[model samples]
Target: MADELVFSVEGPTATAARQISLAEAGFTERAHLQEWIIQNPQVLGEGVLIVTFEFDRWRNATGTAERDRLDVLGIDRNGTLVVAELKRGAAPDTVEMQAIKYAAMASRFSVQLLAEAHSSYLSRSGASVSADQALELLRTHTGYTVDNATFRRPRIVLVAESYPPIVTATAVWLGEMGVPVNLVRVQAYELVGTAEPTRLVSVSQLYPVPEVESFMVGPRSRGDSEQDVGPELPEIEWSESDYAKLRALPPKPTVQAILDLCSASPDTAIGLRVIEAAAGRTVFGARGELAGLTMLVKGRFKRRNWPFSVEWGATNGVNQAHYRMSAEQAERWISSAGNLEESPTSRLRSQEINDFGSPVSPAPHKESGVTPQ
Candidate 1:
């Protein structure tokens, strides 16, 4: 009776089970995926892709005191430092924090990595650059020489199949604090094969936080909450003195006004190409420098954080302008101007223009006294 019960029972899934085992052992290994990510960053995330160097290579090349077990250490075009942490299973809660730390480190001393990247770029291009030549090129290309102090803030990105609940919560909290964090998901599939030769299919996709928020909010929010909230309207307020100061200045609206205008018109060229605010004066080039009219905006503009805007066309030349103002002020500006104009205070006295046009210096209004944020 015992020998008769020892007969084996096999199902169709038995062979597939064996393939799954092999795939888990071979394809799911972290090191293999890590190497793949380094070679093909498109398989992980988007933006400027890069990778961390080998321990000895990084140490000998940069003398950096870092030992990050991540995929890359670099910066994106928007000055966002990339701290990419990859995972085989899921994105852990601590991955976000670890990536933040790496970002902070990169922000402070990114030149070390930039140097290596530049060297690699030159090597790939089959061009040789001397120390002096590299320095000159960096300055010419990047607008300023590489410095460690003015370090831009870094952003954290997690690469995994799915982010743990804790990671999602932490990222949302950080976003509220103005810290940029993102998640990238990599999906793996079992391609058609038997136990003899198996194939693992994989694809990576990025999910920005905004997209996540939209998903979580669902279609219901699309009709109600979204319309209720509307676009994030900017606001600005100016005191009587601020108004008087602006009025006293030449017809030049403050640099803030120019910025405010430019912010409104991303497609136009009337915005502040170069500017400074605070002391109530701004110099910006518009209407084409060849047109020989560099509009100088100047005056005390409240709420420096509000984005400025502008409009440009053949009929209006540089066209109408706009700045963030109170709802009431916005209505007032719209009502009074009849034509397109800026907000906060629509009526401008020529005296305000003189104030911004004529500096408190002997030299030709060389510098705007407003300090940068």
Candidate 2:
């Protein structure tokens, strides 16, 4: 057992201390810890982006009649696949080798394969998401595209409450040789008090100490002759005139309101609903659907002969149409549009629909004093 965590009240004088024994923590059970990690993956620490867990079960290629399961599969900020294995108690001596085998199998995964796996994971959770949607979410969350070259090599992470001396030494040696393997020790502690029970867990990286120099291995080949690079999507580029037109458009009330909200703070993430609500009314008139808005925006951009295009794609978790404009272009458009002063009743109806979270509501043009064309 590891050392127990002690908690004491912070005061001028030391009060009675509450000792939390690791042995008494229920998370010491392997299954419990696994579930906890699955539910709260941030416990793995920063930079780890969880794509899916219990990714899949596979057997060795040699027909050895042995099969294994990967506890958690994800990608890091560097776009490298991460194979994480979890154990509540002391990790076995062969844990490093086990993780290596898992990584060897996982390294062959392409962006499509990962997207499919993630889609399945989401389906099991009752989310009817497609593989493309999952891939888009992955890109948004990690800010790393799955098709990046770094994903060609996979990394291994071993997580346990404790690692035996032999396991630590082997991990150190492997890391020194550039095997991209890491060890994380996770332990739970209970904060006992007169009120209710509270538990705290700590995750610490143990191998390849930050201060120590260690050899890191280059990307490993998946032994496949053909690489699946997935789709080659085109990047959107906006011309100076396109920026000017988008900024100078006579701001309709709906568009102005959205711009005001978005431009109020430079750091706020523009929500999908805000964009959808604004685009629905401003671009396609108050009665527009997402599909219609997509066509209208695309058509408008095309008619202008702009260098950029408005394409419909999955963003965050929803499918919507957005311009392929640079951040600066988008900011300028929002800020400049905010300067316009107009508040039409049709725009108020659009805002009401957005505020009420009802996308199917009929536009109240008649009641809003706007004659239906």
Candidate 3:
């Protein structure tokens, strides 16, 4: 067995209490350690997003009797595939090479393939989730868009009790050469007590040091080749008549309450005051103390009762609440606004609205402010 980790108890006088050996604790078995990691992937460290453990089996390209299985597969925040190879005892000399082969095969995996694998893993674990749902969950958690560009390359991670010097040197060289590879050492310890379970684990990253690790795993290293795409500006201008209609529409208490909250801060409210940029356009814009902190509200009213729709734009430096709702609903809620409940409409984001931009049948009358009889 390797050097065993010991636990000491300290009181008036300190004394060595219990010592844990991976071999004696049965953690030296690959299956046992694998199971523990599958249960608690966070032990791998922060920013490690494990999508599935014991990922689907893959046959060797040579078509022989040989086959290979990846112990764990995941993606970091930047969407680079992470192939984690685990060992219970000493890491084999061929572990890094085996991981490279796995990474090569996994690099071909498209976002759809990853989502399907994740869905299957979820099903096996008794948690129900569709491939689309799994993909959305992955995006929500990692903040990385799942697409071809994002999943083009892969990184490698080796986890074991100890790694040979050769493997450590190779990992460092690969990392410096722009290949994102890391080594993590995980050791098991035992606690002296009458408790039902008396084992503890410690995980530490050991290769490439800490300073270089960040740069190697950062966004630039994820192989993202495309430039950042900004939000598309609206082509149609707001008419002056449109602004008048919006101003005449009755205010909903729900919206007014939000306005009131903004009003409480005079400086902020003044900075965010409504701007009438174009005829028939009324935009309530405000900037918070924080840079890029902004709120914008745009509405288009019809001659009928309420405005046709009101768009409560993104708020709080986050694009969470971009939604459009019918004028009548706003009026009804505002007139009798009480305890507010989350409406399904409020969950709409900008993408959902953009999806509704397809051409539609034209109304009978083309004249402005004209209603069909």
Candidate 4:
């Protein structure tokens, strides 16, 4: 990030932009800074997609938790929610803790809530888009979908004019602990012209400094249930109780429909991207459901806590984990899922195939032994 800017006059006179604090420039967090990020998200990081700002929708049904709002909610290319806390001036010591809390709360949000939030943001911002359109737009851009999806773990990005030493220390510690918290410092410069003044901003990463290799790749494709670390299990048989839990799991109509297509060739392991395209969702959308399925079986089977579908274990050496089972198992699981009971409330919601029709056919898939899976 640039510290200062130099400007030249048409004549011989030249001038340099003055450094200033955001407060000194009278720029506020919500009005100026958040809007800037919302308009141009590249300032946050490469491929960081915005979901909404001022997100206060985490449910507090117990009436205990505070309705604190996160400033800018977004997603990294990997589909993990980017919980950004913005401070116009220096960030306080508790900022890291605050952002972590928001990230934790965000895990409870389902695909619908995120789409609704985005739709609300678009309408309020004068786009006049409905939830379905917002869902489709999000799916098209980021591969995120409302069908049978849950948000992957959220990644934290804290932006401020400056961060106090304690704040950065905590943020660094969180990053080291694999919490995915990042600190970005914004520098303010005033470009003084003969006619008017223009404020310029430059951002430089702090916590996950250039050396932080772990964060460079973005978050792994894992769901909230995978947070509980345990030993690794290559394969395992789920108990009958495992099937019951799977049956009781929230119905993901769209993901299941996509899997129904995959069931046609169960022995072959499909690439992660192919399945994502067929579902009209990003890898994160469908993968979260798959991860949840793996976790459910793990919870019942008490295996190593790594993601493993009862149908098949995760294929290694890939950015996103892909599982394969005998075509029979694939068909059995999805076929049974379609029969799982939906409560009256859930049945009322239109099935997951609203914007997109039932795919005429499944996307292409490679043979399992042929692929890395």
- Write one digit per residue (lDDT tens) for candidate 2, span 43-127: 5655676777765444344433334667888776446788888876678988888888778777656565666678888898789
* Superposed model 4: Cα runs more than 4 Å off: 1-14, 61-66, 144-152, 192-195, 212-373
Model 1: per-residue Cα lDDT over 345-367, one tens digit each:
22333223222221111111111
Query: Which sequence of candidate numbers ranks them by lDDT, best first?
Result: 4, 2, 3, 1
Put down candidate 4 lDDT per residue, 1-373, tens digits, no spaces: 6544645445787777778898888888888988888998876777777888887644354434455777888865445677888888888888888887777777656555666788898888888766555654554444332232335467888888888888878877777787887788888878766577787777878767665663454555556345344334335453344444555667664345444444544555544444555555654456456545445544665553222232211233222324345655654554555565532322222222123322121132222111110
Candidate closer to the true structure by lDDT (higher is better), 1 or 3: 3
Give candidates' CA RMSD values in order: 14.5, 15.9, 16.9, 15.3
Model 1, CA-based lDDT:
0.42
Ordered from best to worst TM-score, the candidate numbers read 4, 2, 3, 1
Clashing pairs in 3: 239-279, 239-280, 240-279, 240-280, 243-280, 253-334, 272-285, 272-286
Winner on TM-score between 2 and 3 is 2
Overall lDDT per candidate, in order of appearance: 0.42, 0.56, 0.52, 0.60
TM-score of each: 0.42, 0.55, 0.54, 0.55
By TM-score, how accurate is candidate 3? 0.54
Off by over 4 Å in 1: 1-25, 28-31, 43-46, 51-66, 110-113, 117-151, 193-198, 204-206, 209-373
Model 2 RMSD to the real structure? 15.9
Model 3 accuracy (lDDT, Cα): 0.52
